[model samples]
Target: MRVAALDDDVDQLELTKYTLQAVGHDCHVFQDGDSLLRELRRESYDLLVLDWSLPDMSGPEIVQWIRDNLTERIPILFLTNRREERDIVEGLSCGADDFMIKPMRVGELVARVQALLRRVYAEPLPTEQVWGRYKFMPIGRRLEIDGKAVSLTQKEFDIALFLFRNKGRLLSRRHLLESLWGSSNPPGTELMSRSLDTHISRIRSVLNLRPENGYRLSAVYGQGYRLESIGNEDYEADAQLAQSQA
Candidate 1:
């Protein structure tokens, strides 16, 4: 899992990074809330380790920004020097999932992070996942849409499953590229964007994913993409509205 650790103290930031990395997790350290927020907007993280006192902004303010802007409810753990009960309450109320008063024991911090991850993303991953009229058999690398088998490349299948697993969340382009292409860099060239767009189009067409079909795969302007499930009645109403506009 990718994690972001924020602390104004350089030494503490380094220590946190080392401890998290030692446990086989990719951890990035940030020195200020602004930088962390910038990266958060560009990439998706599984968890965040934040300090209450920052040079730029308070931890609660950062948590509020995350809750307001991010589509996914990423778990956050506060590692701070503030030990007052009020501080803990405020942090939790501001949307942090967990809190730890500093100076923290590295081992306990790691355990707390693990607990939060488990609590937030604990759904058992099965060999197969079924949605509405679609069945995805990961073990067999097969997909059936409304009783009809549709051929898809391995990459296409992986992308489809990723989108489905994170349906209703706006995934940044960099996040998709990293998950699919193994790179964190955003697509820069026309060819890169076209490649991703082509795969998305193919997946939508093969799955018959449209608002009228109770599923919508849409691009989020400057962001990336979001796949959502809608009720049949809502889809029909949207179709009618679109027809009226046309």
Candidate 2:
């Protein structure tokens, strides 16, 4: 999972990042509201931890901006010094899913975040899940297209399953790498980058991911990858992109 933390205090930001990352989440930290907002525009995050006060904007203001501008209901937690009843009410009313007072307790933060995520995204994958023309048997690590089996390496299967499960979400390279290699491993190293690209290429070809197949796995330059499901209308609209790089 990917989490974004916004706090002006350097120590708090580091603590938030470290604590979240320690628990297998890819954490992105920002010291100001503007920077965080800018990132929210380009990338997608599973959750957000925000301080109530900042030099430029209030946490509620940022929450309002997210609720108004973004289509996804990304869970948000308030981590701040404010502990008044009115403050908590305001935070929740403005669209925050959870509220926590700082000096933040690491255990409580993690528990609250995990609980929020579990509640929001609770749908379980079936043993044999069918998605459009593709069927995935996760336990056996097998994939079938139109009732025909397709062979894939273990790594390739992992990557392909991840992309299929998260279709339409813009997954950052760091998030994808962390999913495969764990948070302890460094992302974007030359070797890791090559390996990631290779696996993606293999999966793209093996899956026959194209508009004709009702799916397109696209590589967003300088960001990451997104597997999009397209209809016939979109197929024609994106014909030129079919020949482009993945």
Candidate 3:
């Protein structure tokens, strides 16, 4: 998962980044609210770790800005020095999903982060998952559409599954690469770009992702990709056809 953290204290920022990276997450740190907000405009993160006090803007203010502007419900966790009960209440009320008082313990931080991710992403990934006409068997890394199999490379399966799991969300290219590669600094070379595009194209072709099929896999110009369900019209047609067959 991709995480963005904000903290004015340089040492704390580094520690937080290291902690998240150690647990297989790509972490990006910002020293001020402005830079973090700017990145949020172009990039999409799975979660956010924020400090209550900052050089420019308060964490709560940033949270409010995100809730007001962003359509995606990205999870936000507050790791701050303020330990007051009122502070906790205010943080949650302002839109943070979780709060932890610091001088942070590494173990506690990891646990909190994992718990937040699981709750937000619906983790403990099931062996078999289905969406509309497509069914995924993660253990075997196999995908099926209407009971017929679709061949995919391991990398292609990973990318396709990630996009399906995060359907309706605009995932930035960097986020997709980091999630697949598990590298904080994913190679942004032209070769890597072409590889990703090729994989997406292949998945679309194999899955027959079209509106009549009840799904659409599309590229978001300079952003990345989003898999979305068109509407219930197609779903209704499929149900009627299935009923007629029955």
Candidate 4:
């Protein structure tokens, strides 16, 4: 999980970073709420670990900002010294999913994080998924075919996942570029569009995606590209017929 942690205390922030990283989470720490909020605007996070008292803003205020602005579902966990019943209620009312008093126990903290993630995000998808001879581990960004690992660059993996998730849909060059490169070409400057074709070609070669292998990645004339599943007999017959006519 990608987590953003906010605490004014330097020592506490470091400890939180170490503890969360120990549990296989990528944690970024901030000394003030403003810095954390700035990072939040640019990147998406799965969870937020907040301190009630901060130099700039209170934890509840940060929570409110997140709830108001961010589109992604992010669970907030408050790690603070406030221990009164009213304090807990206020934190919960402000949209924090869980609250823990300071002097936190690492074990309990980790457990609460896991519980909140499971409850809010619904298990976060399995680490590995198998489709016939292909195996994908999105968390590790790894792919394997028939037990042999295939190396992929970061953008290649991102593109492959995007295509696989949207298989059977015609993904336009604009959509692919925006999805992978974060932006599409401006008016009259479609030169960068060819980059998508290159990536698609590389992905098809690496994955051995073809009609014979139960997968086909094909261009759609003036439309775009489609990744089709040809595993069924009807689709196989159609593919054979198309080949014969060509």
Candidate 5:
């Protein structure tokens, strides 16, 4: 699982990062909440291991942002030194999936995170596939969007999973092609950039939100495309964003 560890404490970040790495989990550490937020905009992780206190923002506040911004449900694990009753209540109320006390236990942490992932994401039956707001029939690879079944081209389905799995990173046509299909595939394969554009068009069509509909697939001008999901439609709606322009 890809995990992000945020803490103002350098030693703690290193310790936790080492532990997570030792267990074969990918981890990214942040020195402060603001930096983490910047990175958060560019990358999404399966689990967030956040320190309860930071100089700029508290862990609970970050958790709330994850719930609001990410279209996919991500597990948040609160790592805090505070053991007070109010602390625990506040963290849980703020959308933390689990709590881990800070002196650190690597094995227990990995086990708990694995268990939470299983409970939250595991499919119930052999023929079922559930991802975000879509469903798939495992046996037939049939996809349903918002309860209505939609026909997806094979490349479209692959592109969908690639987008879902790498929710945060901007993927260029080159990076995308490399990741989806390696050098072995012909240069003019079915998964070319125009093909990617076509797949994205088809996906948007199924959702009833076209590129012209204010729903977006962010074009990074010379770099690549990054999905900007419209779960609560916050693409440019922050009061702070407005005040900055003023």
Candidate 6:
């Protein structure tokens, strides 16, 4: 994934860039939110890592703007020092998918960025995904689970398709906002978030799955929503360890 970092702290920004690159992702850097926003207008990136505090706009505010004004959905990660409960919630409420408290370990940040990218962009296609007992054809995008065919809204279908493809990646809320809502007029917090939630609710209702453990969509506390199987190396290590224990 092509990831961008926006921070006033040059040292941290470079460290983030280097760490992500070492882990096989392309990265870019900006010292402030405004410059990053300008760059957003000119290019496309799979992900953005921003600081919560900036000279121009807070990362949360910038994310809202991207949702409203831009034509694309770019996953946003806030690499800020703000760890107040309300502050983190505000970031997610404003459309940020993942929030990283500043002075974060490099490995942890890289893993998280990868997790979001996998969730939002690199989800694997399902051999077959059934929604409400309706099995879907991946290639043809047709639904037929119970012998009877079921219809879906266009966005609903897209949601199903995306979920089916990437069953295990955790996607951040800000990232989902971009993926589902796209950037238009650099959206305000209210518009983008409400629109995203609406889309999610619409999808959930159509599938008729219990909200408690709805289909593939699961919440990852302190990060974002993830498909059932998405995670990092530690997750892999745990799996290996489990096998050893077994």
Best by TM-score: 3
Q: What TM-score does candidate 1 get on C-alpha atoms? A: 0.86
Candidate 6 lDDT tens digits, 1-246: 557889898888889888987876667789988888887765556788989878877777888898898645678888889999999999898988899897879888978888898778755556666545557766555666466666776666666666555455555555454555553224685676666567666665666543333344555554455445324554566568878999
> Each prediction's Cα RMSD?
2.7, 3.8, 5.1, 10.5, 8.7, 14.9
Error of 1 at 124 (Å): 4.8
TM-score of each: 0.86, 0.81, 0.90, 0.58, 0.56, 0.51
Q: Name the runs in model 6 displaced over 4 angstroms.
A: 124-246
Candidates in order have lDDT scores of 0.86, 0.88, 0.90, 0.81, 0.71, 0.70
Q: Report how far off residue 153 is in candidate 1 (Å).
A: 1.0
Comparison by lDDT, 1 against 2, better one? 2
**Model 3 TM-score relative to the real fold:** 0.90
What is candidate 1's lDDT per residue for 1-246, written digit by digit as tens? 678999999999999998988887768789999999998876777899999999889999999999999878999999999999999999999999999988879999889988888887645367878888988889867898887888999989988988897788778776677667754454564566678889999999988889877899999887788899999888888989989999
- CA lDDT for candidate 5: 0.71
Model 5 lDDT per residue over 12-67, tens place: 88988888877666677898888877766655566788898889888888889988
Q: Which ten residues in a row have the lowest lDDT in candidate 6?
A: 208-217
Ranking 1 against 3 by TM-score, winner? 3
Best by lDDT: 3
Error of 1 at 123 (Å): 3.2
Tens digits of lDDT, candidate 2, 1-246: 788999999998999898988888888889899999998877778899999999999999999999999866899999999999999999999999999998989999989989988977645486877788898898989999999999999889889988887788878777787777765358556688789999999899989998888998999888789999989999976776765744
